[model samples]
Target: MSHAGLFISFEGIDGSGKSTQARLLADHLRGLGHDVVLTREPGGSPGAEEIRALVLQGDPDRWSARTEILLFTAARRDHLERTIQPALEAGKIVICDRFADSTRMYQGLSRGDLRAMVDDLHRLMIGMEPDLTVLIDMDPTKGLSRALARQTVEERFEDFGEELQQAMRTGFLALADEFAERFVTIDGGRGIDEVAADVQQVVSTRLPS
Candidate 1:
């Protein structure tokens, strides 16, 4: 589908500073006079947020990988229908903290090898990819430490430990390679202002004046 606005997504392991960077980009864009929609995954729209509570609260093994993917896809569908698409149609840049890429990394790499299932569901249910994907790349050790410091009810993903996080980092990098055109890997180890400058520079180049 064609859109007048841009769709940008941030992808990374549990705590790779992608979310913070996403917000920074949105703010920068808004400051430049572009209408910006700052949102997140598993729970962008109302219905999706409801699903988010369900999927996030339960035990880590409560849902099987197959079932989990189905739930995630369902939430994503709701998010797209209620939040993302409308904003894009209205010419508002949508900056999402996470998107289908998170599902691929978390579900396929961390949980189970159901990547094929994840891809099929996304293609069938949510057939759209972000116009630009900013992957805030970081060392798993550093990212994991940052993640663990944050206390939240949404500990399901973080509970996966550093090993899984390492795997996820690898997976994200591989995805960056696969979707190189839309994907930009920004080193997330630097200070926030420094990283934000690079992110803003990259996004400014892609976005229209």
Candidate 2:
């Protein structure tokens, strides 16, 4: 779907610092006087946020892969209706920390080979892709370490262990290749400021003058 504003999403394996970069980029763009909306998947709008708690904060086996695709798609649908589409229609930059790509990895690839199902649901329910996607590439082991150190209730994904992280990193890089036109891969193994600087530079090129 096309819109007047830019829809940018950040994707990465666990602890790739995509969330931090998304926030930093939003702040940077807002400082430059662009109307910006910073949001996240599974929990952007109130309804989606409720779904987030259900999907993100439970046992690793709490939801089956098929069930998760449905939940995530439902949450994404609510988020799109309540937050994303409106912001873009108003010509605002919407920076989402995570989006369908993340689900494509976590639920679609992580548990089993359900990517086709995820894509089908996405096409049926959420027929949009970000104008740009910033992928923060990091070492799976290091990223998992950083993620586990956070100790948040949302660690169900991380709780799946480093193997899942490894698979996710590989899957994300493949996704980047699949969607090369809209995906910009950035090394996230550097300092926060360094990664943020690269992110800002990439995004600046895409934003309106």
For each candidate, what TM-score against the reference? 0.97, 0.99
Q: Evaluate residue 121 in candidate 1 and report its C-alpha lDDT on the 0 to 100 scale.
A: 90
Instruction: Name the lDDT value of residue 99 in candidate 1.
Output: 96
Tens digit of lDDT per residue, candidate 1, span 39-67? 99989999999989988875877778788
The number of the candidate with the highest lDDT is: 2
- Cα RMSD of all models vs. native, in order, equals 1.0, 0.7
Clashing pairs in 1: none
lDDT (C-alpha, whole model) for all candidates: 0.90, 0.94
Model 2, global lDDT: 0.94
Clashing pairs in 2: none
**Which ten-residue region of model 2 has the weakest summed lDDT?**
200-209
Q: lDDT of model 1 at residue 81? A: 93
How many clashes show up in model 1? Answer: 0
For each of the candidates, give the backbone clash count: 0, 0
Residues 7-88, candidate 2, lDDT per residue (tens digit)?
9999999899999999999899988999999999879999999999999898989999999999999999999999999999
lDDT score, residue 12, model 2? Answer: 96
